[model samples]
Target: MTDETDQKDQAVEKEAEEKFPIGGCAGAHAEFRKGNFGTFVMRAQPVPNIVPPPPIAAKPLPPNDEIYAVCAKKEIGDRRGKSFPLMRRWDDGKLRPWDIFIARFGKQYFAYENACPHSGQRLDWEKNNFYEPNYMKVLMCGKHGAQFDVETGVCISGPCEGQRLTSILCFVDDDGDVCLTGINIDLDADVEPVKVVDPNSDEVLENNGFKLQSTKREFFK
Candidate 1:
């Protein structure tokens, strides 16, 4: 080949080498040809939500036991059943504990946590409470106005239109009483209820079933 032609070919080869030092470089070659090689670089993998699942430990046996609350003769219908919520104390010395709202829906007793999945609000008008409204199959969230089926904690309305309420797996006992099966008693305070006061009025949300007020000074303050 001519001298000038040979020099031109040598310059092209050097440019190719500078562009892609690696042999089988298709992507790098494409970027270099497009004059955007300076901006091209490997991107980091995207991270997931990273929020871990709830800590579900050993399951409690039938006729759910509670170290703090009262055990009442919870009746359903012709068949009377015994049931209660398993309460736990909080760091604020407040008596906010994990509770199960048990009520007779049709032929059996239904139980679920009192917290709503939407905003972690209580699913009752009263604490450790339930509503047995006629012709209703799901439990209602008094805060966000969410409703969930008694058997399944599936939210039927409100902010969490498709989300299901946090479920506490439970089973019937030998005495036909219901109890939690897969619950971790020490599963942190996030899952437990928090004490709150009325935003407009001076009334505090106590455990009492009325315009509930907190008796404990620490809880209010």
Candidate 2:
């Protein structure tokens, strides 16, 4: 016939490419002999190498009116007895849990205001402790036994003896963190609240927010 039907169609297209060898492996199944091979199908089921997660860096919002960053100056560690608790948020509407206390007087950083002008209570007799564990260098007032003066909270002896402890004019922010320079209250002087000074923190910056972010002073009772 016509050269035996063209050599039996080239021996059935070389026996369908030696039994389907078209990029086969994943449920392989290729066929072609009717039209003479030229379609397409080379699957390999097994895709996984996706990567995406890294973008939340916009940070520059630490001054809606005045300083307010509270941690990360090496975690306040120059060691002189160390202390912490400066969570602030002075009345944008309400909710005033208030507490300053940031002592570390060696590289300078007093703070105060944990309350205890003399029985107004709360000088941390335990929680984050206000000192007096034998002689952590007075500031002691774990509920009564007042001492103050970790660099001037005054008091001096117990029962509000000379009264003081209200301070609050922080610094250390160029990214070292620990800012809070003005507007805790008592406005005046052109409506208060307008500080962001830290000429290395000597020009005094002139003085001294919350909403669902629970930390509760980092737990431990």
Candidate 3:
């Protein structure tokens, strides 16, 4: 009688395994056998293969002489400005981090170093705020209230009067992209903030005064 009962139990287990071959909860298999198909069907389905997507490739850097797009032309409105942090090669032949800004006046766009001619401080009292609040006609230095002409970058008022902000050669390309050209820039360099140079210092004056060219040439209007 005991041998018959053991054989019966073995037959029932083999039947359950055959019907629910995925092998999950025994209680669920029992429920499946009882015709409770809702939860059992979900557990019995095979899992699908999950393939991960490929990594995206980085864009190659352009040659040092070629033009590089800094931002879109639509980003800067008329009488507005935008600032950017970048790495530039100074006269010392070392790559140094620097801040630059682009301003739009009427139909023309101008680009200049964000450093003030006085005290070597950044021009914005507020982050990315480079204009005088009253008229919005000039670039005001947040550090010392120095005002610079939007088109020429010449300091018209404040302690740095008669001085000029270092201009960067840039233009809006045919694609409507604002680009920096005719300059030695390292867009791919790891620009550490701690390495930024003092804009009013002699090193900056020598490098920027004689070496850097103004963007007064013909450009997209």
lDDT of each: 0.51, 0.53, 0.71
Task: Say which candidate scores most in TM-score.
Answer: 3
Q: Is candidate 2 or candidate 3 better by lDDT?
A: 3
For residues 1-221, write the lDDT of model 3, one tens digit per residue.
99999998888667656665465577676777788763442234667898989975443233367787999999888888888878777655577666788888877888998889888876665445688767889998765678899888899988889999989887888999899876677889876652333443332111212332212211111
TM-score of 2: 0.26
> Which ranges in model 2 have alpha carbons more than 4 Å from their true place?
1-37, 51-98, 102-109, 112-123, 126-137, 140-149, 152-221
Off by over 4 Å in 3: 1-64, 90-93, 194-221
Model 1 ranges with Cα > 4 A deviation:
1-96, 127-129, 132-134, 186-221
Q: What is the lDDT of residue 214 in candidate 2?
A: 16
Candidate 1 clashes between residue pairs 3 or more apart in a chain or in different chains: 59-181, 206-212, 206-213, 206-214
Give the worst 10-residue stretch by lDDT in candidate 3: 212-221
lDDT of 2 by residue, 1-221 (tens): 99999998777656544555655432132234354354344535577898899965432223245656656666665423333433333334322334455766556666666677765755654345566555567666655566777777887776678988877777677777666565343212122211223323221110001111111232111
Task: Extract clashing residue pairs from model 3.
Answer: 123-142
